[model samples]
Target: MINSSPGTSQTRSITQTSISQTRSFTTVSLIEMWERFGYYGMAALLVLFMIDKIGFADDHANLTWGAFTALVFSAPSIGGWIGDKVLGARRTMIAGAIVLACGYLMLALPVDTLGFMYASLGVIVVGNGLFKSNAANLVRRIFEGDDARIDSAFTIYYMAVNIGSTFSMLATPWIKDHWGWHAAFAVCCGGMLLGLLNFALLRRSLAHVGSAPDDEPLRGSRVFAVIAGSLALAASTVFILQHKQVAVACVYAAGVAILAIFGFMLKTCDRSERAGLIAALILTLQVILFFVFYQQMSTSLTLFALRNVDPAFSIGGIALFTWSAAQFQALNPIWIMVLSPLLAFVYARQARRGRDMPVAAKYALGFVVVAIGFFVFGLSGRYAVEGRVSSWFMVAGYGLYSFGELLVSGLGLAMIARYVPARMGGFMMGAFFVATGVSQYLGSVVANFARMPAGNLDAAQSLPLYTHLFFGLGWLAAGGAVVAIALLPLLGKLSRAHQQATQAASRRESLAPAPISLNAKNV
Candidate 1:
């Protein structure tokens, strides 16, 4: 009674394949959501906690945060190698979740000493290094060879980040107000634990995927080695965070090292891989510029909200509930959650129509919007009443900023997945993150340009400082846009070469003769 036609069988196979991929993607996305929840919950309060409780001056706080985050981002380079070669991506990711939970728990303790804080941050940097790149690599693996779906999938995956961050960014600040900061940090720890549990329950979905090591039995010696190495990295992180000059030197060194690494890869890789790497490098530089603007959400923008922006939403003489200054950080994720789906839809549609835009072109448009968003922020000063802009202005500016983020930062990982060969995917992904980390530190340094003079400065005195910085940033972004546009012709040519090489390689593989069995000859 069952039909056995090739068409019917092929349709069923496709359906099953789709279901399996969806389940795997969902499992990874959910864990990522929880991880981000823990991370953002802590992030929303970190700088303010340093300033208000630790008594750091604005410059010291900004630079310190920059250094800490730089280390956090840079650690992934080593982690990606570990995931690809030593332990399986799945196992490494789980270990990272455990380490991150412990780090958050440390912060929840009542110890407010600088040493304790630095140690806590060090642990987090190690854990993030292990977790971030591997999680992204898994997503890339799940959709390998499917270029169109990769873009849409990553955009939705990005939504997972916003979903987690939005809740924690809003909730952590409120918890700090009521239960105290330690309690808020405890909630972050709880979020990580929850993510680990969620992953445990659904991990079978990824049983067939991951690096070569995933297929092998567990090795205790490997686990021990990884743990020992992680400890050393964590200690070094503590030292780095404590020394501003050392951190700066390390960041610059990393920047140079990444460029050299790219050059080496281009020189050594086959002709097929060269074009893609070149495209990746050019796009990566654009990402560095974008993150400088992105870092404002946590640093200067948060400080702006604290000093120069009205906290309450209002309309036509009607009053709404007010938010804590820290909670304004939630706006970026809120807009991201709203916009990710729309952008993903457009990408999917364009891909299906065979009219997909180049990622390079997307980067150009992203900077255009980013420039506009900063301009909005800069111009908001013109409308300030008593040196405070309406909350609506923040909403509008964040909307435009978040859109640019989708086009550039959201697609950053996808760029790696598309261009890098599968053999080097993990390491290259790590390198991309390293680039972003370097930029994160740079962004913090840029934030210092708006650093206020000591003393109780009111909103009126601080407003101009932030607006001037915003104007300068807007102009910088406009320049970035112009440069991106100028490079489009080159990027387009490289993209075509990469695509032709890929197709040629695929054809060669498909046309190769099947191996002859010795048994057939014996018969």
Candidate 2:
């Protein structure tokens, strides 16, 4: 039997509480960074690896790249539900990491040709879908009700994501060049193992906290049903891969099914929650636009870096900063790390001083910034065509887009917790990820144009496509920002109501009786 010493027990309790308090922000960030590092490192090299190392054509590699990332983001919705209803976040996270680790190791195996590649990628996709969203929800669990710090926490967590991604990018190319493609994938496996270890060490600290499981037995059964459904869906995907025309029908049907479910869910919520949920739904639409552009990382943008920019030239006799295409992804995170803290401080100071801007307004500003970034991207394309494009253009675009991320996507996690009820908070977070996944799918669709064979399109035909892509993004960002500006007066009203709700919670907490005297004499 396990026996606890009084001193040890007391120390453990204190450690546990401290860990719980910080669970939302710190643990998530660390783990997320590691995961992103592995995932992005793989992503940064994926298309190129398929085309150059594996001998697939650019178009074929692009197709696989888009589909894989889309699936990775999508799997979490199912994973989150499992965590919330039965397995709990900690277990689900553990399972996901294990699956991901196994998937990476599978990739590292020296296998035959196209069939092995497809099978290995399928495993990774399923594993990633389970891993990505739930990990994010795990971070969201740490906040108290309506704490404005929620968004800032996500921004910080996102910073870790970038940092991990940066290191992976920097490392993968070097490792691959020195060893081989298999070694590069092995790096991803190494990260998954490290992340798994960190999480295992921290699990006890998160006990009794984080996306608690449903107490009802029926809830468990329902979750199993969903898992079964997901498996069936996966099987269907396999079938569609074999049969082309059915894929078209499945996409349309999925869209309709999703819209119908959303309508029903909105109608089911309480009035205040429904109002907030509707706003969130609008934000989701906006997020789709953001992800459409962002997803270019694994698509058109990867190809651009590969085909165009010359690797850094060595100075004197030494190799100076010559890097892989994957390293470019590092810039986004670097920007996030620099900007998140400053934005958090500014917003917190404004709140303390009673001069804070509305959430919608901040988000609106973010969208506008995003448009500018895309415009910069378009400009870079033209400049490249003119035979003199600076690497600084790509750098500038990432900076602008990073700022835009701070404003819109970074703020979203906090907004979800603030607006959602306690019981449904995790589910709503799952929904947010679902929205992100869907948008990525849409981005993949858009990316099809960008990856089209140069021989297929005349120069004039390509010009319209590029123009529409960049300027369309610009117009959408600006229009969305304008709409958010108009909604600020209303967002202010919601913010006040949310503040009052918080104050009421605080008042209740303050009204509770003081703890009994610990050292009282016996009667």
Candidate 3:
């Protein structure tokens, strides 16, 4: 046995080694940061640009935005396929970054037509699909077989997302205020280009990470075929983006198909692994619901910030300065930057003390926290003097939403690694996004219900709609959290089943595996 007191130098070295993660982790995180910077910046401005600048009907814009974001999440499944089976992760990612840059450039061109906007969105969607999942997949690969470290690493990687989002959400709106919409889109274009350049610079650090697949090398004629096929697929996405009905159908179909596949895979796993998969699926459903609420930060909530929120100051007498509805979106990412590391420490401390929050409880807590945010948000509308409420209401809601985000989406990555089979890593990561994809659609559905008359936020009829719709959603989400918490025992049992199955397999291997090693050469 080896034992050392905390004061000893040996203890200090062990601590250093524990704290230091892979070099690839940081580089990939930087890639993610810049990618999110463009994505969220565009996202924060998209709806407002449609309604305010392009004159799209509110209903039309919301549906379009929802469908576009849904595809953004869903497209990753195919992207993961290309990464895992066609081009290597790194190459696919680089190609995607280029596409992303092109997409943003399209947006920056100042074509005020709906068709052009949809085309730009489709290009970004396909680009995001290719880039997003492959990057996360690389992170997962780096920490393979080490469950203990995977959670913290994924948490850190998820942090990169908010860090970038915070800056973009804050900066893009300000850019739009000063330089106009085209300039804002140009900023998004510049962000993606920065990401691509960073990835190239840091390519050497990631060589051992997302390398080309051994069996699926890009060579000669095959490369041409892949390129042509990708182009065709990209064209199809543009067509779908222009057609709302078709895009909605595809999103629903993808969601159902993914669920069916995950269910079949779960049935095939051994008893131990089966439990974790089942728990993961259940938790994923809850996560979908959480995103249904989260997605509103850009849509309905943005509307609220514009019409109902007082941008001059908060309820607590703190000064508030939001020049545009889009600028308000920055608050969520800012809160996330503050909250993620703190929550990670709480979870790490819990684990160190031989106690960990059960998967279901964590899910429950996330839902509850978000529910409370919505609850407060809903109340803000009621307490408003005349038509305006304190900006503090939205800020506080964002703070809570940020905490829940870390608990659910941040920890959800770790949950996937813990619960699912290694062979299914790429598929499962894609499947996780499928859940998010569906949530985007669902969020749109909910936001659509709160839609006021087009360009009529100041209308008397619009005020009640925002207040009551949010209040209803808050209660509904809180109730859902309560139901989830009650089912904690079941989720915990499934988690234990995974452990038991692994133990049973180990016992069988230990007892019967010795004889299997007595091959002719050994004998």
Candidate 2 lDDT score at position 330: 65
TM-score attained by model 1: 0.98
After superposing candidate 2, which stretches have Cα over 4 Å from the reference? 1-20, 53-56, 214-254, 313-320, 381-388, 452-472, 486-523
lDDT of 3 by residue, 219-335 (tens): 767567666766776677778767878977887798787789778887787666777788788888887888888778878899888788777754366664445778888888888
Per-candidate local distance difference test:
0.93, 0.68, 0.80
- Candidate 3 regions with alpha-carbon error over 4 angstroms: 1-20, 211-217, 220-222, 267-272, 314-320, 454-460, 503-523
Candidate with better TM-score, 2 vs 3: 3
What value of lDDT does candidate 3 attain over all alpha carbons? 0.80
Which rank order by TM-score, best down to worst? Answer: 1, 3, 2
In the predicted model 2, the residue pairs found to clash are 37-164, 75-129, 76-129
Please report the candidate that would top lDDT against the real structure: 1
Clash number for model 1?
A: 0
Q: Compared with the true structure, what per-residue lDDT tens digits does model 1 show for residues 343-410?
A: 99999999999999999999999999999999999999999999999888899999999999999999
Q: Pick the TM-score winner.
A: 1
Candidate 1 lDDT for residue 360: 95
In angstroms, how far off is 212's CA in candidate 2?
Answer: 3.4
RMSD of each: 1.2, 6.2, 3.9
Worst 10 residues of 2 by lDDT: 236-245
